[model samples]
Target: MATEALGSQAAAQDRTAGFGRLALTALRAVGRVLGRVFGVVRPVAWVLIAATITLWIAGQSLGWWELTVTAVVIGAALLLCLLFLIGRTAYDVSLDLNRTRVVVGERAVGALTLSNTGTRAILPSRVVLPVGNGRGVFDVHRLSPGEQAEELFAIPTSRRAVVKVGPVSVVRGDPLGLFERVHRRDEPVDLFVHPRTVLFDGQSLGFLRDLEGLPATDLSPDDVSFHALREYQAGDDLRHVHWKSTARTGHIMVRQYEETRRSHFVIGLSTSPADYRDDDEFELAVSVAGSLGLRALRDSQRVEVRVQERALPAATGKQFLDALSGLEHSRARAGGIVELAGSVAASLALASVVVLVCGTKVDANDLRTACSRLPFGARVLAVVVSPAGTAPSLRRIGDADVITVGALEQLPLALRKVLA
Candidate 1:
């Protein structure tokens, strides 16, 4: 009998524990739901709720009918806000860019599509686009069930940059502006605005006689430019054996020729804001670099463009332009022309020519220091763009040939005179 009584007591204790655990779980779930409800409530909604409670307390204490009626009106407003907050409208949003890349001054158009996929109709709302540092807002009209609306917009391309367009947000609020809700949808897209470039008609080789490929200097026995006849080597091509020369000299004579050397150019652009007197000068420097680099690539010369500590991949045609399009002014002022020149020299020691594009703020001494780090026998050209619109001048600083131009349009003319 005592054993039975003990078993009954143990079973009763176990049941009580289980009931306590279930009650705690229910409380936790209710707390979470309330937490979310409070999280989205705006300050206005909170103020109205507080006003309703205060009015109700005053009405009970003073027994005033006016206070009670005011309390009831405030409570109704709060209830409406809650109803709007709990019910979310279903929307399908998509953004499409006409082109992912464009040149400066070109129009960049984007299409936005918003479709209502819910069974009920959705009221009018505003769609906001986060563009760069600004925001673009478009009004979305009332969308019926299964209805779709499209909006076409243009992005500003006043400067060379990579503009980010997206993470669209839909804003819904009451007519009285008492409450508001925002829902973010869709990812961002990048638009590349390329710097302007110009074509130049001038020789790429400067003053390097031995390295000059234009007048082909290196002589080979079986190349394009015929030189003089020489005794045929064991491995000389039989087709190149000059029969008349061989017979006259009483020996196997082969044709001699000069082989052309290919030009490999390295372009370094200084992006530090300290290097330029103003934004215009920095933009001109970028344009000059792009123009020169593109011109070299067009002539089939191997080209490498470097900005700050980063080296753009060696490419040609559209690929090269795409790299130039994404170049931006450096935000940090730590690395400037001197450091960039040293880095470029270290990595591209065998480059045929090194071109440095900078602004007027960089003096002749800075140019000298940058040129001194380049490898021996490599020609260096320093282009300084001035914001003062000064006449272009060409002078020698240390081992580098300096060309100073005021406007971007003067780059081609300056290059022809200096590179001629």
Candidate 2:
């Protein structure tokens, strides 16, 4: 009897748990259906609906003619709002930009074109285009069948960035802020606002590289620059065997060559926020690095640009500038110039010139320490970008020549004076 009683109690408990799970699933399904149907309704509409229901119930129960009339008026207004949302729209939208790349302080002009494709006309609606953090709203008039309308918008550029400019949305709703329905019509676009750069004579800086790279001291079995003849080793390639030397010396002789220098230029730009005094100083540092890299590229030299996070693409002028336009300062815990130099040294073992771009917060000791981590024969130039209004100056650290640049325009003059 006792065992039967325990079994019955367990059976009842299991049944109750099963019922609870089934009820929860049903409620979830109902909630999702309601969410889909009423998702576009505004909060004020819901409030008005609830008030109408409550007032009608109270008025009918209390025999108050005034309450009943007020409820009817509110209900009529809400019903009229629904008519505004009951339109079918078939639009072919296209977004066109005059140019996708621009320099700082230059406005980016774009046009949003809409055409009515269906047989019926499209009612007047609002079009919203997102440009970076802000948005522009335009009133699109009624577009008849086969009729096209165009709206122009200009995004102001105050800083360097890669601004996302589109995914144009057409909004349909009443003017009373009751209901809204949005349809995405176009794809997004990226507008690159390149950093300001100055052109300087790279050869005047004495960082030139020969067409055929200069020979290094390291000897290799296979290279272009011949160093000397040596006795043939076990793994020596027979193609490099010196027949004349072998015949004269009566021994197996092979040709040895010195490794040629890699004439690539490297730019290490410090991105730590703590290293900069303000946003302007950081921007100046970025511009300084960009100017140096552009000069190197114009000179037809290989360039490798790096920041605290990673190395940027420097294959062409456009790619380099696009990458630089998207750069932002690193977090507080990010490394400084010393760590940046270390990373660049590890990634690129050989370079003709390594330029360190930083702010005035970096001291001489930091520059010296950073210079020690670079390749032995590579020339180091540390460019310190200070706030505006400060005089430009030049000095030499232990192994790196430091140049203080106050503004962007002073970069070319400072580089010529310091490096020449």
Candidate 3:
């Protein structure tokens, strides 16, 4: 009797454990399914129900069918929402933009190809892409994994802004179209929207470039493109005298060299949100730095971009501009932009011009010292982007020109003046 009782007890314990596991598994599955079901209909569900009931009161038998069909339309909408949630929205995507450039006020067209990889062809859906304005929603109704869909969007920014346009959301609806399933696409892709460049105040950059020689130069050179000619003088080199001009005028003329000087401008950007006056102000500062850096590059002088999050080395290449585009703020000020270009990496401090994007005034002293240490050729220019007008101008620390800009749209034009 004791052995039989023990066996029965063991059997009962095993049955209980099995049932518990089965119950837990059922609960988990039900939770997921129900969550999906409710998520689909929760938006405007009451309105949809009210409409269905009103139709029924009017003696429309098809109203009932509409309600039932909406509930059953789960397959299509659910599939789409699943695509976004699971991050499997597209099989492939491409960024189609010109590598060289598109001028300011010109349209920039980028194409993306989303291929369906699933066995069944996808029906109708919409994707929210990241354009310059913080969001770009694309409509894709039909396509299979192997098939491709072409979409287009306009970048409404005249200034250079890094546009990151990916991780689109795919939304689907039930058969009756009463419910929508939201899916967050997992694909990681982005577009770097460069700031639009323009000639400022009727100042021709081409003339400067040609007179100064190539767009990239560290030292100034002397070459006679065109300079005022003078009558042949004893001190003038005979080689410079033009025999043809001498014959035409019956007097010797010497070719004079044009004097072109290189600009010394430095631009520093900060990504620490804590320092910025506000979201818009910080973004404007970044845009200003980028615009100035590009212009300095074209001027045949070294341009440096130092962000609190990342620092670009001095004597840097042009590619650093693109890198600056995707800059983001950090949680801690562990790596200070001022220190990176100052005590830590002082060699990068060599510049004839300095531009600091003021977030907070924490590193104001360090930046000031760096600018002062530079030769007389270098002058530091600072811009304050504080929303509440709290950020102090750098003039307190040194002889720096400080401008408080209210918006990022003002950055490009402002930098143009500062550089001038």
Candidate 4:
């Protein structure tokens, strides 16, 4: 085992050495090309040389030291610009980041480390990095031989979702800063922003308990629960005659117990123009629907939701929230509560409770007619999510139960009773 370990270590060392040599070779090659280009500046150096000589010759002999010093200075400047400065080249880049999820208005910081691996030092002019909204822009002025610097910025987010943040660009600039050269790394990172959740203060909802689902009580006509006793009637089934009750009452009594079964609930959303002129009312309706659905789901009841032409196919926790987030005010009038009820009735296996989430109010007569259309004994619940700035109230349309919800958040309670 020891022998094998030694061999692996040696191989790793060789790989590292090979990679370093390859990088160094590339940098050296680039440096040589740059050095050759700087050679053209020899003419500028010569001009400075001639100017210095002429000044000395015009009668500054008394300043021999100054002339000698001037010659030396020109020589040094020319050599440095032509030989050393342009040849300084090294290339290295690295990145560091903080937490992924950040507050919308908070600052996010990141660090970048750049190294010039060549024998010559490199001055990188431009570094472009993508920052989330609200994060101020950052600039890296220069990258010395091996420089690491921190960048400060803020991220501004209005909503919650995932956003991909980028592959940064490393730029090089000429000595005069006239032109910038850029190269990019192929790195894409993602950040998740949670939804903007709001918590209402001091909210009371009594209607939430009447949530619709398969009814848990003995209310259905086809159920088996004992409801009450009544005196025997002409059409009373002989089998249902309560002989024990009759003996006590000295009258022919019959069992009139009500049967209970699963409460069937159908939620229909109306997106008709006759319903709401203000978009807020529509949004409120959507919110009420979401709240109502959640409440019913929590109760372990089977609940179906219907929205005219707005078909949302989400069936999971977060999926529903995401779908609801995309809800918008639609005026297509593709279907109405009455039509939705009919459609739902056709699909249900048993009689169901119908609940309508509508922002617009329809004519009372039409509503009454719609209610009359419902199958016998199938209850109708109309929940109005009105944006009329008034407290909610309840009314009746024929045999149907109608309740108004002032706020979208109060939908759960209002629907519970209406559907229940």
Candidate 5:
């Protein structure tokens, strides 16, 4: 009898567990239904709907005429709103940009095209396009079957940035502003507003003129550029042994060569906002870095441009400029120019020339310290951009030559002095 009682209790518990699971499933289904219902309903409409139901309940329970009348009015208005959202829009939409890349202060033009692809006529509606932080709303007229409408829009390019234009959406709503259904049309496009760069005579630069290879002061035993013969070291290669020099000196000698390094130009721009007196100075520094990078690309030299965060792509002129457009300055969370130099040294160990771009707020001592972190035999040039109206000047701090540029126009002259 005890065994039978235990079995009966287990069966009861199993039935209770199954009932609980069914209850949870029902709740999930109800939630999904409510989610779909609320997707097209605005927040204000939800409040009005709740108020209507409450008033109706209160009026029926307390027999209040005024509350019942108000509830009826709200319910009627909601039903009217539902009538406006009855039809679905079938549209063929496309977004076209005249140019995805522009310079700062230039205008970027784009067009949105919408066609009625349905068998019936469609009512007038509003189309919304998200442009960066702002929104553009175009009133699309009623389109008949096989009819199309086009709208032109311009994006502001007042500053250097990467602006996202679109994921064009068609907005359907009622006149009461209580309901809306948004259908996304096209993929977003990125608009690159590149920094203004100055063109200069790149061939005149001492470090860049060498096309074959630059002969470094450091000596290597198995290099192509022979320097001089030296007494054989313990680990010297046997092939490098100079028999003629050994016969003349009566001792073993080996051929030593100066290390030949392919010209690699690296531009390190500081992204720390504190390094600049203001935003204008930071922008000038960016332009300077861009000018140097473009010149390097023109020279067909291997160029790497980077900030405190990551290296910018420099494969082509357009890519380099596009990456520069999105460059921004922030606080020095990962240290400053010294850390950037270390990173470049690690990534490009054979850099022949390294240029450090910063603002006037960075002192000479800091510039020297930053330059000290570069790879050995790499010639370092530091460009310190100042605010407009200051005269361009050049100075040597430790091994790095620091050029102070006041404006974008002064960059060519400042670089010329460095070459001189």
Candidate 6:
């Protein structure tokens, strides 16, 4: 009897669990159906539904035939609107950017091509494009079968950013504003707007001097400046042999010349948010980095630009600017200037000078610590991009020169003082 009772209890429990699962499955199916039904339902449809419910309640309670008839009419209209807005149409859209990358303040233009691929004429519709945080809406006219239309647009490039443009969405709606449908037509494209760079005429004067007749400590046999005579090695160039010294000493002696060191600048930009007081300060720092790198490149010197862990490849002209355009502030609290210093020291051994571009939030101690990690004899410059209204100042942290600029317009002047 005890075993039979136990078995009966187990059977009841199993039946209850099975029923619960079946009920959950039914609820999910119903939810999916309702979701599909309401997904395309517009605001007008919702108002109609509410009015229908109210009218039906009144008709049942007060036995009003007029309210019942009115509710049925609204219900029929809603159904008809949904039927017209549910089907897909044959339309194709293609976006072509004149250029995917451009400098700040330059015009970025593009064209949108719309084609009607179906047999019937496509009714007038609105094309919506997602541009950055905003939307672009263009009214498109009716297109007959095998007909096409093109629209031109210019993307705003007043600031440095990576702006996303479209997955083209074509909006179709009823004339009565009862229902609407959207068809996604194209993939998104990225436009890179590079930071603005200042053009400066003065030469860089600090670390590595000009290769034209510049004296240096390191001696080489192939350079121009004569240093001392040494015993000729097997691989020494024949032209470098000092014939007078060789004849006097009765030994093969080659002329040694001091190697002229040309400046190779490596600009390190700290992207950590903690290093910047705000977005404006960060943008100023980026512009400073770009301007300095461009100046060095203009002078025909080797340049390397680094933001966070990534190093902008060795490039000049548009390619270099394109790399700078994509620089963004780091969301994570990664190590700021100190970490950047360590990375630069480890990787760029041949760098003649290091330009550290940061915001006003960094203090003198942080700057000093970062400069300490740099290779010996490398000139270090710390540029602090301060907020507007602050007075510009110049100071030194150990061997590194620190220059503070209140605004981007003041960068050229501050750079002259530091670089001089």
Candidate with the greatest lDDT versus the true structure: 2
Per-residue lDDT value at 398 in model 6? 97
TM-score, structure 3 vs. true: 0.44
lDDT per residue as tens, model 1, 131-221? 8899899998889999999999998788888888998888877765566677889899988888887776755543333444533555776
**lDDT tens digits, residues 167-212, model 5?**
8888888999899877789799999999988888754243546554
In model 3, which regions exceed 4 Å deviation?
1-189, 195-265, 313-321, 335-345, 359-378, 385-420
The regions of model 6 sitting more than 4 angstroms off are 1-39, 43-67, 86-88, 105-107, 176-178, 204-263, 387-393
lDDT of 3 by residue, 180-247 (tens): 66776555444454443333343212123343432332221235345567787676678777888889
Model 6: per-residue lDDT, tens digit, 1-420? 999999999999999999999999999999988876676678777888999999999998999999999999988887776666643455788999999988889998999999998888887887888889998899888899999989899987888988989989988777677777777888999898988777776865344555563466776778778788999989889998889989999999998888765577889999999999999898888888888887787777888887777888657767777777777776565689888998899898667889899987888898999999986667788888987777778898999888898777787787778756
* Cα distance off (Å), candidate 3, residue 103: 10
What global local distance difference test value does model 3 have?
0.57
Best-first order by lDDT:
2, 5, 6, 1, 4, 3
**lDDT assessment of candidate 4:** 0.58
Better of 3 and 6 by lDDT: 6
lDDT tens string, model 2, 1-420? Answer: 999999999999999999999999999999988886697789999999999999999899999988899999999998888888877656899999999999999988988899998899899998889888989999989988899899887888999999998789898889898888787888999999999988765562435567668787777788899989989889889999999999999999999999887677889999998778899999999988888888888877889998986889999999999999999987766688888989988988888788999988887788899999987778888899987787888888887788898999998888777756
* Better lDDT candidate (1, 3): 1
The lowest-lDDT stretch of 10 consecutive residues in candidate 5 is 203-212
| Candidate number with greatest TM-score | 2
Question: Which 10-residue span in candidate 4 carries the lowest summed lDDT?
Answer: 201-210
Candidate 4 residue-wise lDDT, 226-255, digit = tens: 667788778768888889989998999877
Model 5, runs deviating above 4 Å: 1-33, 204-206, 230-254
Name model 4 segments beyond 4 Å from true: 1-265, 331-333, 348-351, 369-378, 409-420
Provide the lDDT at 192 for model 4.
46
Alpha-carbon RMSD, candidate 3: 15.8
State the displacement of the C-alpha of residue 316, model 6, in Å, after optimal TM-score superposition.
Answer: 3.5
Cα error, candidate 3, residue 141 (Å): 6.8
Each candidate's lDDT (Cα)? 0.82, 0.87, 0.57, 0.58, 0.86, 0.83
